[model samples]
Target chain A: AQSVTQLDSQVPVFEEAPVELRCNYSSSVSVYLFWYVQYPNQGLQLLLKYLSGSTLVESINGFEAEFNKSQTSFHLRKPSVHISDTAEYFCAVSERNFNKFYFGSGTKLNVKP
Target chain B: DAGITQSPRHKVTETGTPVTLRCHQTENHRYMYWYRQDPGHGLRLIHYSYGVKDTDKGEVSDGYSVSRSKTEDFLLTLESATSSQTSVYFCAIRVLAGGLNTGELFFGEGSRLTVL
Candidate 1:
């Protein structure tokens, strides 16, 4: 079974300040990592995913996550945050070829302007 | 929304009543999922369908049942409403043919149901 842990439950940051959201996973085999954003009352939208390759994955919205095998972590980072970035972020993990997903509790990113 | 919509965007129902939430998607994706969102738990899968009439239970499928009669529609039913069932529900879809290469999934806006 694979599981994910999002280190922080809530993170408050000022606009334009760099922010990082920590995520870690526990699995016996290969796994895929994903970050999703949920605005207020909306469903989750895919922010970014790390399948394989450079270890660092980026989203079109200036968010990035790095896959660290040694640390079993995939932390999300943004150089400059905006108030619009305020939302509930989730980290999820799925084993290779599996349909079931394991999710972290979630982190509420409160970007104050 | 990825051509996916959930009916009854917000609802407040009394306990012990029956409720059924609908999810419609025009994308024709082969995989459909039902998830619930709460304060700290994030999104938890309640049920999922791989194809019409092919359904599976998820982590929190205890009091929920799902059915899919067509390709575009998936329904979640609560046998008897309970206060614990009150939360925002979301429906998501993913293409099956793409295999694991499908990087992301399309999500519906969401349906907020409150059981009073």
Candidate 2:
């Protein structure tokens, strides 16, 4: 079974400041990584995903994540964040065979104005 | 939008009562899943269906049961609701592209159940 670990439970940052959310997974086999964001009183929405390729994956909203095989980590980063980016972000991992997805505890990104 | 709808968006029930939550999808997707979201536990899968009548248990399936009779409908049932079962439940469908699972999911608004 694969397990996802998100180191931070809450991250507070000022608007326009850079932010990073850490995610790590435990799996020996190849896996897929994903980030989902949930706004207040709504379901989660897919932020971005890493299937394969250059190890660097990005989303349309200026957020990017790097898949580091050695560290078994996929950390999401954004050079500058907005107030709208304030949401609970969840990190998920799925095996290459496309079984089930395991989600982390989630990190609440609070962007203050 | 994926056109996924979960019934009884908010419900208040008592322990020992039978509860059923329905997930309806307009798209005829082959896979549907049920997950429960908690404060610190994130989301935990309860059950998933690959095809009609073909369902499998997930990590936290001890007290939950699911049935899929049609591709557009997936039902989750709790024989006897408990206080611990009070949580927001989400239904998701896997997005397939190029005859392969894209590893992406479209989730419903979620059904909030409160067992008092």
Candidate 3:
């Protein structure tokens, strides 16, 4: 079974400041990585994903993640954050088959103005 | 939007009561999944259905059961609800495009259940 570990439970940052949410996974086989964001009182939405190709994957909202095979980590980062980016972000991992996904404890990104 | 809907957006029930949550999708996706979200536990899968009448257990399936009779409907049931079962439940459908699994999931708004 694959397990995901998110190092930070809460991250507080000022608006326009850079932020990073760490995520690590344990799996023996090749896997896919994903980041999902949940706004207050809303369900989660796919932020971005890493299937193959380049190790660095990016989302339209200025957030990106790098898949480091050696570290077994896929950490999400944004050069600058907005108040709207304040949400709970979850990191998930699934095998190549995409049969099931394992998620981490999640990190609450609090962007303060 | 993937057109996923979960019933009873919010419910308050007592322990030992039977609870059923329904998930409906308009897209006729082949796969549907149930997950529970907690404060520090993130989201844990309870069950998943690949096709009609073909379901499988997930990591936290000890006290949960699921049934899928139609491609658009997936149901999660708790035979006897417990206080520990009080959590927000989400239903998701796998994104399949061009007959390929996209490795992306579309989630529902979630059903908040509180067992007191």
Candidate 4:
């Protein structure tokens, strides 16, 4: 079985400041990781994913996450965040087969001005 | 976009009343899933359908049922709604374009159900 854990429930950062959301997972087999963001009153959207190769993966919107195998972590980071980045972020994990995903509790990121 | 839509974007019902949510997709994807979102719990899968008439229970399948009679339509039903069941529900489809297994998923706008 696979499970994800998001260390933070909420993170408040000033606009243009760097932010990091920690995520850890437990799985016996190789896994695929993903980060999703949900805006107010909307469904989740894929922010980035790590299927294979290159431990680092990035999204189009300046968000990136690195897959650390030894630590079993896939933490999301952004050098600079904007007010528009305020949203709930979720971390998910699945086996290499990608049959289903196990998600974390979620972390609410509030980028203030 | 995947052209996925959920019906009854918002609904209010009483306890013990039966509620059904519909998910429709135009892309004719092979997999459809139903998930519920709560404050602390990110998203918990309720039920999923692999094909027409082929449905399976997810982590939180109790008190929930699903039906899929067509390729593009999946319906989730609550036998008897409860207060705990009041949450936002989302629908997702797995994309397998051109025989490539990208493991990408597209989500619907979501349906908010309030059980009192």
Candidate 5:
């Protein structure tokens, strides 16, 4: 079984500041990684995914995550963040050709003005 | 949008009472899942279904049961609701493109259940 670990429980950052949310997963032979975000009272939304890619994947909203095979990490980062970026972020992993995903506890990103 | 909807968006039930939550999808996805969200425990899978009449337990399936009798509907039941079961429940459908599972999940708005 695949498992994900998000060491940080909460992250606070000032607006326009860079931020990074760390995530690491149990190494697997065929891993597919994903990042999902949930705003207050909203359902989870896909931020980005890494599936047999160039090791780096990006979201339209300027969030990016790099799949580090050796380190077993897929840390999410944004060069600069807005107050709207405050949300709960989840890191998930699943095996190729499988639909079951193992999600990390989650990291709450709190962006302040 | 995957056209997913969860019934009883908010409900208040008593302990030991039976509670059922329904998830319906118009996308005809082959996979559906039930998850519960708590303050520190992110989202934990309770149950999932791969096809009609097929279901499986998840990480937190101890007190939950699920059934998928049709392609578009998946039901999750708490045989005997407990205070510990008071949480936000989410239903998700898997999107498999070209027969490849990218692990993309689309979630419903969520059903909030409070047990006293």
Candidate 6:
């Protein structure tokens, strides 16, 4: 079984400030990582994903996450976030044989104007 | 767009009553999934379908059932609705085959169900 841990429950910051959301996963073998975002009362939307690649993957919206093998972590970072970025963020992991998916509790990113 | 739509956008039901949610997609995605979101918890998969007539249980499948008889429609049923089942339900689709697979999921707006 695979599991994800998002230590932060909430993150508050001002507009244009840099932010980082931490995520950790427990898995025995190679796994696929993903970050999703959800606005108020809306369904989730994919922010980015890390498959078999250069440890670092990026989303067009300026969000990036690095797959750290040794640390068993994949954290999402944005150089600068806008008020529009205010939403809930989630981290998930799925293994090769996993038909089901596991998601972390979540990190609420509250961006203030 | 995921081209996915879930019917009964909002509903209020009583406990022990049976309820069914419908999801329709036009993208022809190979993988379709059902998830629920609750405060303080990330989305949890209730059930998922790989292909028509091929479905499997997820981490939180105890009170829910799902069936896929056609390519574009996936149905999720609550045998006996409970207060605990009162939450927002979302349907997601992903194309796992061919080069069209982006590994990214497309989600519907979600169906809000309140079980009294």
Of candidate 5 chain B, the 10-residue stretch with the lowest lDDT total is B95-104
Give each model a TM-score. Answer: 0.94, 0.98, 0.99, 0.98, 0.97, 0.95
Please write out the lDDT profile of model 6 over residues B1-116, one tens digit for every residue: 76899989999999999999999999777789999988788888899999999998888999999999999999999999999999999999875545644567778999999999
Q: How does each model score on lDDT?
A: 0.89, 0.95, 0.96, 0.93, 0.92, 0.90
Against the true structure, candidate 6 reaches a TM-score of 0.95
Error of 2 at A17 (Å): 0.5
Worst 10 residues of 3 chain B by lDDT: B93-102
Report the lDDT tens digits of candidate 6 across residue range A1-113.
78899999999999999999999999998888999998987788889988786999999999999999999999999999999999999998877544556889999999998
Instruction: Give each prediction's DockQ, rounded to 2 decimals.
Output: 0.73, 0.86, 0.90, 0.80, 0.81, 0.71
Q: Model 3 over residues B40-105: C-alpha lDDT tens digits?
A: 999999999999999999989988999999999999999999999999999999988898888999
lDDT tens digits, residues A9-76, model 4? 99999999999999999999999999999899888888999998999999999999999999999999
In the order shown, the chain A TM-scores of the predictions are 0.98, 0.98, 0.98, 0.98, 0.97, 0.96
- Clashing pairs for model 4 are none
lDDT string for model 2 (B63-91, tens) is 89999999999999999999999999999
Model 2, A1-88: lDDT tens digits are 9999998999999999999999999997999999999998899999999999989999999999999999999999999999999999
Residues A21-104 of candidate 5: C-alpha lDDT, one tens digit per residue:
999989657788999999988899999999885988989999999989889999999999999999999999888866578889
Q: Candidate 5 lDDT, tens digit per residue, B1-116?
A: 99999999999999999999999999889999999999878888999999999998899999898889899999999999999999999999999789776679999999999999
- Give residue A98's lDDT in candidate 6 (0 to 100): 40
Clashing pairs in 1: none
Chain B TM-score for candidate 1: 0.93
Question: In candidate 1, what are the lDDT values of residues B60-99, reduced to their tens digit?
Answer: 9999999999999999999999999999998888754444
lDDT of model 4, residue B78: 95
Q: Highest DockQ: which candidate?
A: 3
Q: Which model, 2 or 6, shows the larger TM-score?
A: 2
Please give, as one word, the docking class of candidate 5: high
